[model samples]
Target: MTTYVINLDLPGAVQSRHLYGHFAEHLGRCIYGGFWVGEDSDIPNERGIRSDVVEALRALNIPNLRWPGGCFADEYHWKDGIGPREQRPRMVNTHWGNVEENNHFGTHEFMDLVELLGTDAYVNGNVGSGTVREMSEWVEYLTRDGDSPMVRLRKENGREQPWKVPYWGIGNEAWGCGGNMTAQAYADLARQYATFLRDHGDNKLYRIAAGANVDDFGWTEALMKSVGCVGCNSSGVASPYQAISLHYYTMSAEWENKGKATVFTDDEYYATMANAWHINTLLKRHTTIMDHYDPCKTIGLVLDEWGTWWQVEEGTNPGFLYQQNTMRDALVASVHFDIFGKYADRLFMANIAQTVNVLQAMILTDPDTGALVLTPTYHVFEMNTAHHDAHVLDVVAKDAPVSRKIGDKKLPALSASASTKDNSALISLSNLDLDHARTITLDLRGREVTGVTARILTAPDVRDHNTPDAPDAVAPREWTEISRVDGGLQVELPAHSYVTVSLDLA
Candidate 1:
C-alpha cells in the first residue's frame, strides 16, 4: 500500500463546536413515532423517548439540537403544544404529512428530551402563521424566571422551572413554507418579530434571523445591511441578531420529481459526493459577505438546517421521507463534517435535517416492531464527537486532487484536520476517492505518540447499509495496528472512508 501521511505539527488547531449537531422536526416518523412514543409504549423509554435512540445521540456527544421545525416552525403555535395533553389542541402539521399533531410531544416534552441528552435547545419561533404575541409569550414561557403570565401558565401546565434555551430562530425558510415572503419582506418581518422576543437574563438568546434557501447572498447581504443601518439598539439592547440562518441539502440526482435514492450508479454516487462537498464553497461565499459588513465576527453563519435530500421510499408514506442509509451516505457525511471543522471559526452552528425518520436521519424506527436502527451517518457523528468543544487545530493537505466539472466542481481525494482537546491529540481524515483505498503515513513529528487508536467507518461494499433487520451492518470498527513509525504513523484507509486517530501524548 502506498501510504500518505498528514503532518499536523505546523498547522494550528481548527474549532469544532460549530460542528454543532442535528435537529428533529414535526414531520413524518420523526415526531409521532420516531423520537416520541408517549409515556406508555412497550419500548424502553425515558419519559416517552426511546432509550436506544437517546443512547445513540449521547454517543455522538451532540452539542445542540434545533426543535419543532423546518417549515413546521412557521406554522407551529407553541401555546397549542403545551398544557394538558388531552386538552392541548391538535393541529395539522401543514408542512410534513398533513397529519394531526397530538400535542403529546410539546414544549415540556422537547425540553425534557434535550435535557435527558445533555444538549442545548435551539427553539424556532412561529412567524408565518403565528403572532408577535405568540412568539414573545413562547420565549417568556421558556426563559422567564419571574411569575409573569407566561411563567404562571408554564407552572400550571406542570413545569414550574425554566429551561435555558439559548438559541431562537425567528422563522424557518421564509421564502418557502415559512411565510412565502420575498427576501426583503422576510427581513422586515424578522426584525419586527425579533423586537418583541425578549431575553430573560440567564443567557443571551442567540436570536437568528431566517436566511436564504441555497446560495442567496442577496438575502444575507440585504438582511445584514438593513439590520445594521437600523442600529444595534433599535429594538431593545437584547434585540441584536446573533446568527443568520441558511439551509442546503445535497441530492445526487437533482431533477426532482423524486430524486433517486438508495439505488444509484457510480456516476450518481460521485456526483452526490461532489455536491455534498460544495458546502465549503457555500460557507466561504456567505461568510465573505458577512465579514465585509460585520467583520468582527459578531454575526454567525448558522446552517440551522442541512443534510442529504433523497427520494422517499416507494411503499412508505411519501411525506415520511423514509430512505436507505448506505456507506455512501456515511462518506458524504464524513466530507461534510470535515468542511464544517475547517470553517469552525465562522460557522457557529449546524443541525442535520433531523435526528430520526427524516432526511439523512441519524436514527430510524419501525413502530410496529419497535425497532431502532442507527444509520452509518450516525456512526460518523459519534466518531467525530471528540472534536466538539475542542479548539480547532489548523492543517492542510498537499497534492490532493480537486474535482472540477463543467458546471460544479470540488476538491481532491484527501481532507484532514487536527485538534488537541482534553489533553489528547485527535486527527480526522476523509479519503474522498470513491474507487481506491489510501495508505496514509501521518508524520506527528515532535508530538509524542502513545496509545494510538483509530475508529474507521467503512463497509465491505459501498452499497452496504443499515436496515431494520440488520441495524449494525455498517457500524465503526477499531484498528490499533495503524503504526507509529519513527515519529510518524502509517495508516491504511479504505476507499471513500472517514478515519479518526486518537493519540495520548507520551
Candidate 2:
C-alpha cells in the first residue's frame, strides 16, 4: 500500500482553465471530413461544421482553441481563404500534404466553431511565407470594429459583429517549417510583425512569440529580449503579455520509428513515459531562463503544441498526421496536465497537438460513414475538467514500490495532482504500473472529504482503444473503489488507469 498527504492548508498555483486548451489545424481530414462536412452531408452539421464533433468539444467545456495551421499557418495566406467559397483560390498545402488545398473552411468557419464551443480563440499569424502587412491586416479583419476597409469588408462577408480573440501566436516553429530562421532572426521578425499587429476595441490580444523547439533555451532567452510587442513600451510602462510559446510531443525518441500507437510493449511504454516526464526538466530549465529575463515571472509559457505523436494509421496519408489514441495517450495527457497545473502561475495555457482525427486526438472520425468515436484521451480530459480554475493543493505521495524500466530509464509507478475550489476539490490520479493494482491511503490533513465520486479510465489491456465500430470499448466507468474512513480515503486504483476524484469540501 502507498500513502499520500494532501495538505489542504497549503495552496499552490491556481490552475488556469486555459491549460485545458485544444488545437485544430488545416491538415488532412481535420478540417474537411473531420470537423467540417458541408451542409449537404448526412452526418448532421451546423452550417458546415460537424454537429457531433461540436457537441463533444462543448462537453469538455474547452477554455480556448488555436486555429489555422501548425506549419500550415505560415504558408497560409488569409486573403486566399476569404471572399467567396467558390471564388477562393486553390493552392497546394506544401507544408502538410503537398496536395491541392480547398479554401472552404477558413477564418469565419473557425471562429464559428469557437463560438459554438463557447471558447476563446487563439489565432496564429503567418510570418514565414507571408508579409507583415498580411498578418497586420488579418488581425484588423477579425478585431477592428471601426469603419475601416477591412472591417467593412468583414461585415460585407456576413459577420456583422467582430469576434473576440485574446490569444495570438506570432508564428509557429520559426526554427523549422516556419522559415527555418535563426533564434535572433526569428526574434527580429517577431518584433517587426507584432509591432503593426494592433489591438482593436476591447479585444486585448495576448501575443505569444514562437517558442523554442525543445530545450532550446537560447531561443527562449532571445525571444524574451526582443518580443517587445505586449509588455511596456520603448520607455517601459506595462498591460503585459510577457508570453512565449513551447512545443513538445511524446515520440519513440525517433520520429522515423515512432513505433505503433495501439501496439507497444512494456519496454516501449516505459521509454515513452520517460520522455513525457522529460517535460519536467524542460519546464525547470525554461522557467529558470525566464526568471533571468523577467524575474517576476510576468512572461507566461504557452505550450501551444503537445500530445503524443505516433506513426500514421495504416493506409492513411502520411501528411494527414492521423494516429490512434490509446491508453498510453490518456496516461501521458494526465501526467502533462498534472505538470501544467503545478506550474499554472507561469504555465498559463497549453493546447494538445491536434484536436480531432489527428495526433493524439480526443475524437476520431471515420471517413466512409462519417462516424465519431471518443478516444481514451477524450475520457481523461472529460473527467478532469473539474480541476479547471481550481487552486492546486500541495500533495506529497509515496511511490509504489514496483519499478518499471526501458533501457536505462525508469519512472515513478504512480503520479497524482490535486486542486480545490470553493467548497469543492478535484484529485486526479494515475497508476503507471503495467500490471498489479495499488491500494492508496489519501490523507487530507485539514479538510473534510465528502460527497466523493470518481470516474476512472482504464481497460483490460493498455493498448485497448475505441474504434468507430466499438466506440464504448474503452470509456470511463463510475469508480466505486473509494471509501471514506475518518480523516482519510482509501482507494484501490486499477493499474494503467487515470482517475479523477471529486469531493465536496467541508
* lDDT (Cα, tens digit) per residue for candidate 1, span 24-113: 888888877888887888888988988888887888778888888888888888888887788988888766767887778989999999
Candidate 2 clash figure, as a count = 1
The estimated TM-scores of all candidates read: 0.94, 0.96
**What is the TM-score of candidate 1?**
0.94
The per-residue C-alpha lDDT of model 1 at residue 95 equals: 63
Once fitted onto the true fold, the runs of candidate 2 whose alpha carbons sit more than 4 angstroms away are: 227-235, 238-241, 398-408
For 1-506, candidate 2 gives per-residue lDDT tens digits of: 88888987677788999999999998988888888898889889999999989999999999999988789999899988787899999989897878898898889988888898899999998988889899889889999896899999899899888889888889899999999999999888887777788889998888888899888998998887663333334555442344889998887668778888988888888788888877888888888887666666768999999999998988999999999988899899998987887687789999998898999899989998778999988988898888889899977866545556666666778888999888888888889888879888888887766688988889999899999788987899899999887678898999898888888877
- Error of model 2, residue 214, in angstroms: 1.2
Worst 10 residues of 1 by lDDT: 230-239
